[model samples]
Target: MKTWLTRCLLGGLLVTSPALAQDDDAPYAYPEDEPARDEQQEAEEDAYERRRRQVDETDDFRRVSEEEGEEGDFKELAGVDDPNIGFAVELIGGALLLDSSEGNFAKTVAGLGLRATWEYGRTFNLEPLRENLWADLRWTYGSYSDGTDFIRGDTGVHYFTVAPAYELKLGKTSLGIFGQLGGGIGYQTTSITIDAAETKVNGIKPVFQYGVGLRGRPRLSNKLSLSFRVEAMGFRRGYLNDIFLGGSIGTAF
Candidate 1:
C-alpha cells in the first residue's frame, strides 16, 4: 500500500510540471515586438541628440554677439569730408597805444574784443585755406582805460576787418597768418576839466585803419579745436594814428 501511494504522488507532480513549462513558453509568443521596442529607443536617443545640437547653436550665437559688442567697431561713423563747420566766438584782450605819440609820452590801455571766424576748407589741412587763402570778416568793439598823466581819459573804439588767412600745421598744432584791411568812424570823449568843466577831447572823429594778425589751433577732435589769435591795426589819420593790438583764446567748432 505504501508503494502504490508513492507512485500516485509522482504521477500528479509530472502533470503539473508540463503545465508550468507551457505557461513559460506562452510569454515568448510575440517575438515581433522586440524590433519595435528597439526602434522606439533609437528614436528617443536621436531626439535627445537633436535637442543638444540646438542648444549648442544658440549658445554659439550669443557668444558671437557679445564679442562683437566688446570690439566697439559699431560706434565708428563715416562719410564726412571734414567734421568741422559753421560759426564760433572768440574773446580778445590786449593793449592800445596812440601811433603818433612820437615816443615822447605813453599811456596804458587795456581792452576786450569779440570776434567771429568761418572756414571754407573741407579737409583738416594743417593749413586751412584754398591755395593758402581764406577770408574772414570780424567786428571789434573795445574801450581804453588810462591810469597815466599824459592822457588820463577813457576812449571807446569800433572797427571792422576783412582778413584773408593762411595756415601751417606742425604735428597736431596749426599756425595761421592773416592780414585785414577795413575802416570805421569813431569819436573821442575826455575827462579833463577845462575852465571848471569836464570836456570831450574831440567830437565824432572819423577813424580809418588796416591790420595784421596771427592765429593757432590745437585739435580737440576731428570736428573741434582750441583757437588763439593776435592782431595789430594801424590807423590812417595822423592824429588818430593808433596801434590796436589784441589776443583771443576760444574754441573753433
Candidate 2:
C-alpha cells in the first residue's frame, strides 16, 4: 500500500511541475499595484507603435517602386533621358524598283525625299513595346529613266504617305539601333516623260505600303539632334510605285 502511494505521489509531482514553472516565469504582482500594471500596459503600447512604423515603411517602399516603374527603368538602363514625345525631320533616299514586266526590262531607280516622324508618347501603360510607338509622314519623289520598255520614257511618282510605326528596342543602350515596323495607306501619281519633251500624267490613286527597318536617335539636349534609320519598303499596288531599300538621316526635335 505504501509503495503504491509513493508511486502516485511521484507521478502527480511530475505532472504539476511544468504548470508551476510556467506560473513562476510569468510576471506577478499584487492586484493593488497600479504602477506595475501601468508599466506593462505602456510596454504593450510601445510594441504596437513599433509594428505600425514597420508597416508604414513597407508601404513607402512599395509606392516608390511603382513610381519608378512608371518612369521607366529602361531609360535609366539606356542612359537616354529624352522626353516621352519627340519629332524628327529626315532627308531620305532609296531605290525605286519599277516592275517592268511584259517584255520590258527593269532597273533600280534611286531617289530622294523628305520624311517627318512624331513620337506620340506611350499610349499604353504597358512598358517597353508600347513606349516606342511613332507616327511617320512622308512626301517623296522618284524618277526612273527606262530605255528597255515599250514606253521608252521616263517614269516617276509623287508619293505622300502616313504610317503608324512601332520600334522594338533590342537592348538598353544609348544611341541604340533597333528594329521597327510600319504600314499604311497613301496617295500616289505617275509622271511619264517621253523623249525629254512630251510628258504624260496619271491620275491620283490609293496606294498601300509596309516596311521593316532599323531606326535610332541619339540622346541630345535642346540643340539639333541627329537621327537615322534604314528600311525596306513594299507596296501592294501602283507598280509605278517604289519598293526601295533605303536609309535616312536628319535632325530630331
Candidate 3:
C-alpha cells in the first residue's frame, strides 16, 4: 500500500512539474515593460493617422488649386464687351431772329453752321416718362447774314453745350426719332452796317437749345448712320435776345 501511494504521488508531481517547467521556459515580462510596449503601439498608430491626414489635406489643396486655375484660364479666354460711345459731324442751315429794346431788330437772318459732337451712351431711364436716354457734348459754330433796307449785318455765333437727349422708336425698324434739349453759354459777334456805318458788337451770353430729329442706319451697314435734325436755339442777355431755327445732316459713329 505504501508503495502504491508513493507511486500515485510521484505521478501527480511529474505532471505538475512539467507545467511549471513550461511556464519557466516561456518569456518573462515586467509590469513596466508591458506599459512601454503598449505605448510604442499607440505611437505607431498615431504616426500613421497623422500621415493619413496630411495626405488628405494635400489632395484637397491640389484639387482646389486646379479648380481656381481652370477658372482663371476661362476668364482670360473670354473678352469684355464694348461700351457705347460715338463721334459725329454735322452740317446745319438755320434762320436767326434778333430782338432788342427796339422790338425785333432783324426779322429773319439766314445762317449756315457746323457741329462736332461726342455722344455718350449713358442714360437715366426715367421709366414710363422716357427711355433710350442719351447725352452729348456739342461744339457749334454758325454765321448769319442779313441784308434789308432797315438792317444790314453779319453775325457769328459759337456755342459749347451739354445736351441731354432722348429717343423714341418709330417702329420695330432700325429707324428712330430723337429729341435734345440743352442749356449752356455761348459767344456771339455782330458786325452791322447801319446808316452806312460799320459797328461791331461782341459778347458772351447764356444759351438754351432744343432739337427734334430722325436717325437711322443705312440698309447696308450698322457702323454708320444718317441723321437729320431740326433745332431751335435762343440766347438772352439784358433786354437783348436772339433766336435761331436750324436743320442738320450728320453721320453717327
Best by TM-score: 2
Q: Give me the runs in candidate 1 sitting further than 4 Å from their true place.
A: 1-80, 100-103, 120-132, 135-154, 166-172, 191-208, 237-239
Candidate 2 regions exceeding 4 Å error are: 1-84, 101-105, 123-130, 147-152, 174-199, 222-224, 238-241
Tens-place lDDT per residue, model 2, 79-119, is 13435356789998988675564536546777678889887
All models: lDDT?
0.61, 0.66, 0.64
lDDT of 3 at 21: 48
lDDT per residue, candidate 1, 1-253, as tens digits?
9999999999998888553345564576467666545888899999999999999999986665445345674422222355666445688777766543446554446655677767644333433342244455655555655545553556566555555445444445477566656555554544564344455665555556677777777788977888887888665543646676778888987
Error of 2 at 174 (Å): 4.2
User: What TM value does model 2 have?
Assistant: 0.56
Q: What lDDT tens digits, residue by residue, belong to model 3 across residues 1-253?
A: 9999999999988888443344576577877767545888889999999999999999986675456444464222111122223566777777767554456465566656666655443222223222255565655665767788667988777776777776776666646677878877778799998777889999887777676666553333445666556656665534566676777787765
Compared with the true structure, the alpha-carbon lDDT of candidate 1 equals: 0.61
Q: Report model 3's TM-score to 2 decimal places.
A: 0.50
* Winning candidate number (lDDT): 2
Q: After superposition, how far is residue 48 of candidate 1 from its true place, in Å?
A: 41
- Kindly report the root-mean-square deviation of model 1 from the true structure over all alpha carbons: 14.7
